[model samples]
Target chain A: MAVEVVYRSSRDLERLFMDKAEADRHDKMLELAEALASALQNAAPTLSEKQADDLGIFMARHRELFARAFKNNPEALAELPALEKN
Target chain B: MAVEVVYRSSRDLERLFMDKAEADRHDKMLELAEALASALQNAAPTLSEKQADDLGIFMARHRELFARAFKNNPEALAELPALEKN
Candidate 1:
């Protein structure tokens, strides 16, 4: 009989972003989207195809908020992470 | 009126991501979310507060898809971009 040990590591998306602030912004955006979707679902359990389209429009409009937020937080965009030169 | 030249620069979120591949992934994720939301809205033009909640929940659920997609693209996570050693 052979025993195998499995190891699992934490899934941190921070690795994808340039810095902690950027990652934090992404996390907040996801949370906001989730909250909005949940609120919509609770208000109307049933949605027609047309209603779905409206919801999407709302989301698209709100997406601009991310850029606006970034504009207000110039520090987040102050400098690009220096890339390694090979 | 005093003539003032105003300059506008491109708002590139790619600067936030670690690399081009990571930025591409983020862009795809946003596009998919917008599409889904748009489809949902078109299907149902009107949504109550509860319906909004449902949409938020849906967005939250799909958020995990980003991680799953990343897992399939291990190259995106191969190694962190080396930080500048000051």
Candidate 2:
């Protein structure tokens, strides 16, 4: 079955960064981070306490990457919901 | 600034799978895969042909994980746009 792909974007990362590749990587990383967050959140009720803690730690470890991805795109940054203040 | 995280779900993985942790992991992986797909799509216009090829290869490498994630939830699988046939 063909899956419907949705490309949702509020800002253009390529335009914001001088390095287009960097922007691409950052954009991808941010999306991955969000996906990870959603997965964790959705599974929260069923996750064992240890699994939950592990997921939390995983997020904390990668929080910097997420922050960096958003640094130039405050508009996108504003859209991020799981980013915690470091 | 606080980011608004949107958890959009059409099916519950936990309910579909007898193993809840596996379900959580699958859900998370699927989300990550989508995010990766979006990143690649958004950056396509600017990506060097080589970079594009590399990203495609990366997706190919992980496609199994994605397929496994969607094994039970065909609805979620239907939502996936990047899962190429193997």
Candidate 3:
């Protein structure tokens, strides 16, 4: 079998990445997600922990758009795909 | 202002991408997330609509690792970062 080198994010050891940069990026993303979740919980105490986490990760994943949306460009949110309605 | 060209995903007109390929990819990801949310709701009728959408998008974002974990490598999930516990 061919040997392969992979890097694992310290924050998420279950994932293996072919590139160190990618691994670092993944770790940073998770860090941001955690922070966002905490902030969401603090801002809306009524929100369930899972709901906060779900929104946190979702926002973290699309952080660029969110950042823009918050920066005098609320219209940026309209650029986001509409979530499926019940 | 300098002129700029961008691509808008048909399914998500609010967002613009510098690259057509990236816009297409984003669109496809959202499509997958929507389908996943529907399936989740169908399987777990008690889940709130937002919960299902949140989970669907989360899974779609990490589809690679999830696919590996589902394919007899459950340990792969362990590599995922632990979300904050309330």
Candidate 4:
């Protein structure tokens, strides 16, 4: 079986931010996550195991980040940078 | 049937950022997303409809913002603000 994977790296972050226009890495991540959900809302039935896994990774990462981007947040996001191992 | 809803507002964004701690608003969002995915990774088969819908809305919004928060982003996240309406 294909191994479960995780995304990482500055480049991964850069890829995640690929669609962002500018000055929006924070906001766009949420939006892209939304789009993924929209896709899932319509795609749950047909998504493959691997596809589902991919989406799962995508969504979890999306929410994880969303919850921690507050202005009053306890630590710098730089410490918890995006993954690169995937 | 419950409608396919969207989230909005500064408060929603604030809620989203709730787990963020202090900062970076920029990086924590991604982490939160990952956590959500971890949850999904474990709970997909049993998630309730409303629960799924809520999760969908949450995910979409997350992706949307993520893709837009780049340093060179065109618009500020403040402009797109999270949805407040249920």
Tens digits of per-residue lDDT, candidate 1, A1-86, equal 87654322123343465466666555544444443344343434476544433443344234443222222321221232222111
DockQ of 3: 0.03
Give lDDT tens digits, candidate 1, residues B1-86. 88653322123343464466666555554444444344343434454555544443344234443222222321221132222111
TM-score ranking of the models: 3, 1, 2, 4
Local accuracy of candidate 3 as per-residue lDDT tens digits, B1-86: 99999998787899999999999778766776676566445433555787666665665565555444333333444454454222
TM-score, second chain, candidate 1:
0.41
Runs in model 4 lying further than 4 Å from the true structure: A1-39, A42-86, B1-23, B45-86
| Range of the 10 consecutive residues with the lowest summed lDDT in candidate 2 chain B | B69-78
lDDT, candidate 1, at A14: 36
Name the candidate, 2 or 3, with the larger DockQ value.
Answer: 3
Worst 10 residues of 2 chain A by lDDT: A69-78
Q: What digit string (tens of lDDT, one per residue) describes model 4 on residues A1-86?
A: 87654333332455433334432544444454444444454434444454445554454344444334422232333344354223
DockQ of each: 0.08, 0.02, 0.03, 0.05
- For A1-86, candidate 3 gives per-residue lDDT tens digits of 99999999777879999999988877766766676556435433555787666665655555565454333333444555555232
Among all windows of 10 consecutive residues in model 3 chain A, the one with the lowest summed lDDT is A68-77
Give residue A43's error in model 2 in angstroms: 29
Instruction: Tell me the lDDT of candidate 3.
Output: 0.60
| Count of clashing residue pairs in every prediction | 52, 2, 4, 84
